[model samples]
Target: MSEDVFAALEESQQQSPESVLERLIETLTAQKNYHRLFDALLMQQKHAMGLEVLQPTTFDNVPDERKKEFEEAYIEAARKVGNLFLDEKMYSDAWLYFQTIQEPERVSEALSKINPRTVPEDKVEGLIQVCAYEGANPEKGFEIMLQSNGICNTITVFDQMNAQLKPESRKKIAQLLVDQLYTDLVQSLQYHVQQKMPIAPPADNLRELIAGRDWMFEGGSYHIDVSHLNSVVRFARLLSEDDPHLAKVIELCEYGSRLDQQFQYPGESPFEDFYPAHLHFFKALVGEENDRNLAIGYFEKKLEMEPDEDDKQMIAYVLIDLLTRLKMNERAIELAETYLSQFEDPNTFSFTSLCRQTNHLDVLQKVARGKGDLVTFAGALLDAQNKPQPQES
Candidate 1:
């Protein structure tokens, strides 16, 4: 039957190949031989147009009108063959044709039709890839992999897909994964709250999920987001508290602080949104039994960089007190003198007294003498002397 259609093409050189192809198509249509019809039409169409048959790359050279006409017909034929292959339980063959047509839905449907338990481990990865590829319903792919293999398998595929995607696509996929992680975290926390239990850290993949994403993409540069830093800090703190892993807690806090310090929170100094995270991290750093020096170092760094008036004073006070208690007198005096020179009085009635109490007399005397203002320093000293220290309980 196929031979008869090609036989007529020899009848005339004057007749266009399109004309001959059209007649062959009519014959195949009349006989309901759609399978051979698609091939004959494709070959004649490509041959007349000087394109390589079955070479999808040559599709670009074809005019839009012609491309659309054949794309529709070819996709339909591929879908028919794909569905037939699926019906015959030839999932791999069905997947190939369905994927070639770039119909994600049908490809997903074909994969879903297979008995997952029977799918070979090696082939399952490919099926997972097909599902997760761009426009290939990654969320559905994730579900399928999770159901068939496990969370570990799904995560492995996701990690691979994330690595393969370009920046823009990777960013998009990263956000999707982040949203998914956030959703899961929230749901789990909500369940814990309802059960009157403490909220626990999420699966370890939460870290992997966020590992590749830059918190901010501005002007083609990647920047960390303080909120993401805070989330990590909180995660670390929660785990540390639950398990009392001081070393890991310190590591997380230090990392969070470093990231926080590196990123200006997109607005004013001493970002209001970041204050809680920063405060919590500081507290966690100090809260550990043996890392007091780490806490002092963090506070000193904060004082060195802090620009906000109140924040600087607050940090100076903490740093000065820590230094004094640790008997690091040289650094303590240096910090006090610096603070006295640049620090704006925080408008609290007792801020001078607080400074006087936290700092040693020698440091205050040196600052006062250096400023050539004995009178003001004298008043501060008098106030400090007059204010009785709190009695020990």
Candidate 2:
């Protein structure tokens, strides 16, 4: 077969380019060499366009009139090769082709179906990259990392995630971590509780399991890794209020709060009482009526008592963001008007944006005038002037 292919290839040099391409395609297709077939198809398109086929060139070099045709050929060839790779479960290779055509969804769907546990060791890293970092199936990728590499490595990966990751993907991964840590803590705590008490405690809820169990923390004993607890509870802040995992996360914070003083590491600013602060924040986010008010009062006190300007600003921003998330925009606007007036950097936290959200351009103008920021003051004046007047009956 090799000799015949070589003979045909040698013979094709004497034939027309079109005939040569046809023979190449037929031969490569017969051998199931789709990768080479992709190159051959691209070569054919380049030949038709009267461009040099020996070297690679971007679509930018293609004439305006021919660009669409060239792109169509590229997309069709990519889809053919990409799907062939996908059908063979060659996900990483498939991603290469599909990504060029901006069709990650096809690869993402295929990746989602894969059981990471069953994947070969040699292939695991490649699949992880395609799934996790490539934005194909981050949740599945995170699961693979957690299952295969264990919690420590998974935490490292989460910590090292760059800003390029979508907030939604980050949230999903965070929720997974929360669920895993919560389950681990519950199981460990249940075992400890069973050793001491004859009656088995509630199996699922962390809060119920740990309730009135002061003896559980005797001699600085902890059910789960305190560091893991701290990391996961912090990650839980990224979760949406509506996420079912928020309740579990809040429960985790409750567990953390009971840890000995040495384990209760102080956090920055408003979360100085790390577990307690986060517990209240998560409670408020969970939208229990009493807890919501308590959480608000908790942060408000932090803002009031904090002497450091920077720390106070951070607390105010946290409170303002929480209020906004809870749809207490009036409260958010009031806090912004009070505490955020001095913060001029929009990139940090946009006082202007909050003003816009509340439709209080007058406040923006006032704040702008106070700061002597002519650009913002003038813009606010123009915006107010352009408002559609209310019609008098």
Candidate 3:
């Protein structure tokens, strides 16, 4: 068969996952078709392959005649196509071929064959998809994709895995993605820095600081919870290149550090209030704030660069929260008035936090309807915000 004919036939097979699995099985069994099937299957996924079986017994209980027909079509397609090759570098082409195979169930059955084996994901991309979506062994799949040389393919797999993760798992995987990419990304950024791109730190202590544990480093059984958030933030930075939406997330959660203050003064800076993981993340992103102005400047640059709407508001809101804490009530009020037409209700965490900090009643009274979290908590934060200097009060 010509490539075009095989291509057309492959398209037809892809529409039915069950049929594809059966065909693959039949091809695997047949002497003449075996080679051809491997060719096509190998070309189908640059990593791993598996059938996404919705019903295992469907094939088992099929009438012999129907099973025979399905098997024959698959086997025939395999024989006619002859030996084809799938290269890891040629993932997109392989993706199209796999996309043409029909029957996810059939694909899943084929996958059942390989589940127990620790196979390299680069050899079977479809399995990664199945395992990720169909509840197969994802940890193994994640490792292979990360190690693959093909950057684009890795990104594709990452996106697929990211979509299916739970919230807690998302934070974990996002961290994993960041950890995996940070070195390369930092190297890339380092190059940009040498070439005069605006950058804060030269990838020096960053990698070394992150690399401490893989070997002899041990924190002992008395685990420090603060360090965990710091680790997550480091990973978040690495994961951000592909997920720009995090700029908004960072605005909301970036200030969420858990580091315990060491000194009696500086009266618990906002920077130290969240988590050490966040501090590491912020340091990587904005560098050390030698002074308060530098910290505010960092915030300014962030606000200017943020593309997401929610992110923009959060940035302004967090700043307002900071200013209110700093006794810069006038500035906090100014921002609330400016952003009122934009931030709106419901997403008023930042706004309320600001009003609470500033004690500017006129700015806060209009937003009084939300209650509890709105009034009580905000009022408490307001009172705390009103505390006199550490020595004076």
Tens digits of per-residue lDDT for model 2, 1-393: 668887887789788888888899888888878898898888888988998776433676688998898889999999998998898888888999998889899988888888867978887888788888877788888888988888988988888873556788889889889888988888898888788886864567787888877989889989888888888888888888888998888788788888898998888788889999998898898767898999999999989889998888889998998888898988888888887876656545788878877788998999889889999999999998998889999
Name the regions of candidate 1 deviating beyond 4 angstroms: 1-41, 44-68, 89-102, 113-123, 133-137, 147-150, 163-393
Candidate number achieving the greatest TM-score relative to the actual structure: 2
Report the lDDT of model 1 for residue 201.
Answer: 38
Q: After superposition, how far is residue 190 of candidate 3 from its true place, in Å?
A: 13
Best by lDDT: 2
Give TM-scores for every candidate, taking all chains together and pairing residue i with residue i: 0.30, 0.87, 0.30
- lDDT per prediction? 0.53, 0.85, 0.45
In model 3, which runs have C-alpha deviations exceeding 4 angstroms? 1-117, 120-123, 134-140, 157-164, 182-281, 284-293, 301-393
Which structure is stronger by TM-score: 1 or 2? 2
Q: Candidate 1 at 349: error in angstroms?
A: 44
Q: Each model's RMSD to truth, in Å? A: 21.7, 3.2, 18.0
Model 2 weakest lDDT span, ten residues long: 52-61
Candidate achieving higher lDDT, 1 or 2: 2
TM-score of 1: 0.30
Candidate 3 residue lDDT tens string, 1-393: 346544545775778744554455555445344444544443333112243233332345445656665454444443233212122223223333343453223333334455423565455665555455444335434544555433345456555556455444455456545554444444543554455535434444233322322321122211123233234343353343235534433432322321124311121223323443243333333333453455556566666777776667766765665455445578668876665423435434455555544655545544453433465446655665676656865
